[model samples]
Target: MTAKILRTRLDCVDYQEACDRIQNWAIQRNSCYVIAANVHVIMTAYWRKSYQQILNRAALVTPDGMPLVWGIRLLQNAQQTRVYGPDLMLAWCDRAAQSNLSIYLYGTTETTLVSLTRHLQQRFPSLRIAGSYAPPFRALTPVEEMADRDRIHASGASVVFVALGCPKQEEWMARQQGNLQAVMIGVGAAFGFHSGEVSQAPRWMMRFGLEWLYRLITEPQRLWKRYLINNPAFVVLFGLQLVRGLIKGQ
Candidate 1:
């Protein structure tokens, strides 16, 4: 089967296997690595047709949130551990090091980008880092956007880790498809995770569906609406769909 065919509804491969798929695809050098991202993305998929199309069309969409795994299981019973963003970044970095694949860092603040680069270099002492950039917060003109793409192409990087959060990153990757010769993965908060600006929830908290809560507590000002409002709404919608599915089965 192709790497991303829905296995039940969980719609994901496990970790070591995810790494293998990415490495094999990177070796092929003809495609982008589209991360399935997280609950917000899956919730958006349910609410937004455009987001749904983006997820479905992605070459690979690994389950990046626990709620997404549950939703996938609700649709069809499937095992899926959270393939969260930070973990995905580490997986790709290790692969890049072992395979001699160069990488470019894009998005996030310049300070974060610098720290991430140095940390990766320290961890993977032999890793080839082709380049790094931090774009202005404002929208780019067509020429400016194309110029950035050209810079990445010129950097000779085989993989680009983009940290420009959610729909923005997904939209950016879609636009750059077949334009730059490498894989571009939109990794959300992974830049902060690797740089020590955010703390990861304990594994048990993640398993128990409270990681969002942990995050909400940590950054309540930024996340109150996303978790307190959106997450509950997602649960209610998903539960209804699951109930309907069960009834149909009987």
Candidate 2:
């Protein structure tokens, strides 16, 4: 089931169930997209009606942040744990290796893709990576987009891990829903984290919901506004929702 947190719907799923659902879809070659919803993702959806619809229409939107997990617990299910994107990608890779499901990599720079492919192969020795592509940073023309689609289709991959970051990746996946012929997952920065190009927050920090703080400290110029602005707003807005729910009950 899904719970609405600040008007954004997130799936109440643990890692195992999320992996199972993706695995099944991959095996069936389903053309769908999965979103790993974190604070930035949820806040983006909350502000943008069009983006929110894209998220609502997704095949799955896993709670990728601790706050979202807690939000789910308060709003609907008490036992919901986070299904983080990078970890989910690793888990699915392990499953795909065992099941012989080929996967394609999309987004990120060519260097990162090379490192990510190497790291994945080393971690999951039997994994089959059908192909990898790092498109130019700018928007693609219609012809260019179609060519890229053709390349992925020709690879015959059962799943495509997209690392193009939040709204862009989500929008890309939405556009390809009926055309991709594979499960496209918008994994944000999994490629960088997995490729060792980016450092992840320590486990303790993640457990305590301080990962955003760690990130803000690490990349202040790039992330300060996102964390500082969105975090407090989420708390205030969600607190109002909780209070309203309490009033309704009374």
Best by lDDT: 2
Alpha-carbon RMSD, candidate 2:
0.8
Q: How many residue pairs clash per model?
A: 0, 0
Candidate 1 local distance difference test against the native: 0.77
Full-model lDDT for every candidate: 0.77, 0.92
Best by TM-score: 2
TM-scores, one per candidate: 0.91, 0.98
Q: Could you give candidate 2's per-residue lDDT for residues 21-110 as a string of tens digits?
A: 999998888999999999999899989999999998999999999998988898879888989999999999998999999999999999
Worst 10 residues of 2 by lDDT: 6-15
For residues 1-250, what per-residue lDDT tens digits would candidate 1 score against the true structure? 2222222123457677777877776778856756755767766666777867777666677777877766655554465566777888888788879889888999999899888888889999989989999999888899999999999989988788888877788878877887877887788888998887778888899888788888988999988887877787877876777777679999
